[model samples]
Target: MSNLKGLAHLRMSLDDIKSATNDFADNRILGRGGFGVVYAGQLPTTHRSACEPGTPVAVKRLNVNSHQGDKEFLKEILMLDSCKHKNLVYLIGFVSEDTERILVYKKEDNGSLDKHLGSTDLTWEQRLRICLGAARGLEYLHSSVGTEHRVLHCDLKSSNVLLDANFEAKISDFGLSKIGPKNMPHTFLATVPCGTLGYVDPEYAISGVLTKESDVYSFGVVLFEVLCGRLATVVKSKDEYEFLSRLVKKYYAEGKLDDIIFPGLVEQMKPGSRELFSNIAFRCLNQDRKLRPTMRTVVKELESALEHQLINLDDDEEIIGLSGSIGVYNGHELVTSLCFTTNKRKYGPFNPEADNRFSGSWDAGLFDGFYGRHGSYIDAVGCCLKAAARPKAQS
Candidate 1:
């Protein structure tokens, strides 16, 4: 077994990694990028090195053109390695050789959100959940100044959101990500615009100035993608203003917002959904960053929307019992049937696996602000639980 070090304090021998990748065979390759290619490989676990357990991992091999980016890669790894949020991808280790740099990470099973959402395999509900999960991840990064490197996810889009077995979202690829202090305390200077074509912040695109607002704006484009089920950059027009945001805004202004929503959800969509969802989407898509709602707000609204979806609106006021099916948190974390959201203060974490087999670890309670609140929020959680209750339940 190779001697391993703490993340940031470690690097793997290139020969060992190369051997795992069979000297970099095409079949071993998992993905490619402007700066590198990721190969699927099995590396020696520091604890057990004999047979090479072949832990499923992605090995990011930096290309020759990334001479300067190599330094940036190291910096990115060191900075990101310390963050332990569930929403962010974890870096396993890395390898460096003469003009060669490779980063290793756990291989997410489902691949990019774009691969599933862009294809027909994903359902409308899944799309909504994944996007919501991703937004929270970004929100956490933006809100927690210490964890985030001041700047925002400069290149967020469907492609950058990787999904795991249960379809949870994990942000990946920090290549063009801007490093700044949070709350836009400083300006990020760049000579050229660096981001995916469809999701680039308009202001950043024209001025080469990076801000948290830039990331917010790009996230807006992603919101539109989630809603419209199409690429923002692909909205071609033979006339003036070929941008997807402009078109969406125009349609929204013309009261044709429904024309853009994904067809499958259109039929199942609930009342008052268009305005709320449209408003949320437009707020994210707002050209002026100041007008956009913070990621926390966006996440809450989406969660509320999902809650709205869980119960029967026609008879929602009455308390009801609940039952089984897949329940998701922020469209990413999937927990089994048992779930609860109470306004109970100081509620703690519940790990079902510790006792019962099903319902895994869940936060004791969410909605800290509404804790002990005597209103519809608490009532709703209770009422919904009653409506879907398994003849008995507790948080």
Candidate 2:
């Protein structure tokens, strides 16, 4: 094993974590998951640490009853330490004492994408940025960077996509993440199929063969969810439920996709951008794994769609500001911004493990509020300005 001391991540003590979280108060609880519970915490020193005590951090404590073993726990910590990217969530520190294990991460004030799905506050451009951020994170995982093997995020879902104060999306929850073999020409790895119910890849579920393509399939579902402003699976009636992909394909086949597109989003979407996104979503959802595009291709298509969305905006000072902010001119190529707009007060701390019916499943008249919501166009422009000011390029 690599020397743990050489790693850049902090090896935290349990006593320090206890002090930060006030002995794990209920009020400090941020969310819960199958593996463990997450609490809102603060480190004592911001000067020497990634965050100050005033700046909140999230502490995930593994449950004593959890099925995860020491091996899986070490894998998660090492994966977070080894992988570094702007779009991917990073570990601040960890604590392992006796049977207690904990991990710390930078707190995202806006919470997960699932919490904001049906809200109209998120604009099309903001949604595009979120998608672009996630795509880039997945690309980094699939890309051979910093390691001989590639990592696969087995559990890719809206709930796993976290938004910072700027609403910049970062892929989180690496408990189910896996790493592919190094220097092998193999296209897929065989492992037990495990993922969320709605987002699991159909092929992996049947054959138990894991691959980067599995993540691609789940991402396609998320794409449609973002487009339609609904969950991946919707309840049709008491005994019937419909998957969003099947519903979208049916609409697309009948030449009436607009019928299903989120109401306000249709007005904000540029024709070219919408077409490109739809095409990519379709290709990503291909049943034949061999036919799916690689993560690199997915990132290119998403960036292309973003370019169209930006190009369609009215040419004003705001537009120029937006363009300048997200587009960084490094040498010759421009790496655009992937920031977003969010309302901090809209969503309070949520129990990620607790299933809220209103947010989890669809109800009759669920589409009512989703259609009439409106937001300012300047959010994108403002975000672009922020992006342009950063001196260093991000992965």
Which candidate gets the maximum lDDT versus the true structure? 2
lDDT of 1 by residue, 1-395 (tens): 12223553556677777777888899997778777788887775442332345777778888878633665676657656755566777777676667677777777888877666455556655666677678778877777647445546677887888898878788877766666765354446664777877688787789887777677777778777777777776634655336677778899899898887767767765544445556777887777767777787777666655444432333223212222233344565333333333322222121111222233233331211211111111222342233343355556
Instruction: Give per-model TM-scores.
Output: 0.74, 0.76
Model 2 C-alpha lDDT per residue in residues 91-132, reported as the tens digit of each score:
888877788888888888899898888889999988988898
- TM-score: which candidate is best? 2
Taken over the whole model, the C-alpha lDDT of each candidate is 0.63, 0.73
lDDT of 2: 0.73
lDDT for 244 in candidate 1 is: 70
The residue ranges of model 1 lying beyond 4 angstroms of the native Cα positions read 1-9, 45-52, 145-151, 183-192, 235-242, 272-275, 313-395
